[model samples]
Target: MSDAQELAALLAQLPDAELAGVVGAATEGRAGLAALHAVARSLADTLGHAPDVIDVTPDTLPVAGYSQSETVGGSGQVGAGPVAPGIPVPPAGIPTAPSIGGYSSAGVPTFESVRDKVEQRYGTSQGMGELDRQTPVGRSVEEQWEARAEAARERLDQIRKSMQGNDSE
Candidate 1:
């Protein structure tokens, strides 16, 4: 028998749970292989030649640290200072601004101020005014519940009459 036929025969002997586990593992393996293949194809397309072998080691791997490329002073060299850990280095060409709880010296509106301005300009929040108008004015929760209950009772009476007529026929 061929390898596929032999594998299928072996799989048939396995319990339902074991077979499902094998199938799941095989699916995950296939997906991982497919992803690796796609990455290789993308690299080949981008670069003139694709690498035959990628030798990844601890030394070759990127370490997380603040990049010294951003010079503190007008001097073209980076200053020797201890950077706070876990702080990320911003990418090149992007303007960096200091912010305090969304408030900035760059004339950017803070979160609270923005919300207030929007409320003032639009006359309450987007749909709050419409919601208020739609709501029954001066009606208590108990009154609304009683009104809904009366409507339900009327509907139930109609259904009962229809059912009684059907039974008589």
Candidate 2:
């Protein structure tokens, strides 16, 4: 047996606290072994291997360049569609889909009127995607409204100052 195995055997025969140091060393050794394995894997991958590719199932064989695994059938038929997971199929007669002729000539919200609540709630935003906006109107409406609001605030401030001066007189 190896020295590690012999030491481990001897340690196993000891009482709990008497073997603690050896157990702790063994645990630290496992961490070092893991780090060594990671370094070796990184070096192997740098030399043109893929660690993710190594984690493939037998029935699912590699097709285009050996990274992706496509399911294989008995009669030589390959997987024909996308492999996207977590996509829930809509129930019968639901008709959950994007609409054709979805837009009107005026660009007003129309068709199914299936308002995306997240888009509508956020409206115009710096962090959101273009499609995540409530409507095409969101940008222009917010801009015009803000400009008008600033002008109105300035007029209100001027009126307030004038009223205060008149009261002082």
Candidate 3:
């Protein structure tokens, strides 16, 4: 037999759980490294040459010379840091916080809606793939997805209500 057919036969012999586990482990291992490699490649392409070194350490970056004493909860109070001489500070009355009330509740609905749709669609389906149809493994996977989606929806609702309450006060 050809190498491809031999490998396919071996894969076909593996139990569904074992096959799924192997695929999941391989994907998880590659994802993080793949992201870092892609970012490095993009940066190299942008710079027109591969950099000899990439420094991610915060202290190595250029910024106004503010002493450690001026940092939050340092000698200075929070949001009261004193910039070094000649470093520009914002004019009065302008907001210093990145957002009006910090992070927003906008992203929760998008993810929860997608999860809800997935759960609704897959909840009644036999399985996602031909091999999984009518199998116990398929039922278990569907149930897990449904449970996670429901929990996330509930959590998002609670957060939305809480944020609304805060806004009204």
Q: All models: lDDT? A: 0.56, 0.52, 0.55
For model 1, residues 1-169, the per-residue Cα lDDT tens digits are 6645765777799655444444443344356566655554454545444444332222322356844444244443466443323334433433346664355655466888788778787886646766755667624555788899999999999999999999999
**Number of the top lDDT candidate:** 1
Candidate ranking (TM-score, best to worst): 3, 2, 1
What is the Å distance of residue 45 in model 2 from its true position? 69
- Model 3: how far residue 46 lies from native, Å: 60
Question: In model 2, which regions exceed 4 Å deviation?
Answer: 1-136
Rank by lDDT (best first): 1, 3, 2
- Give the per-residue lDDT of model 2 (tens digit) for 45-162: 5555433322112343335664334644455556654543323343343232344245443434563554664566667554465653456687777788899999999999999999
TM-score to true structure, per model: 0.20, 0.22, 0.25
Candidate 3 Cα lDDT to native: 0.55
Candidate number achieving the greatest TM-score relative to the actual structure: 3
lDDT of 2: 0.52
Q: Can you give the lDDT of residue 44 in candidate 3?
A: 49
Better of 1 and 2 by TM-score: 2
Candidate 3 lDDT at 74 equals 37
Which residue ranges in model 1 land beyond 4 Å of their true spot?
Answer: 1-98, 101-137, 140-145
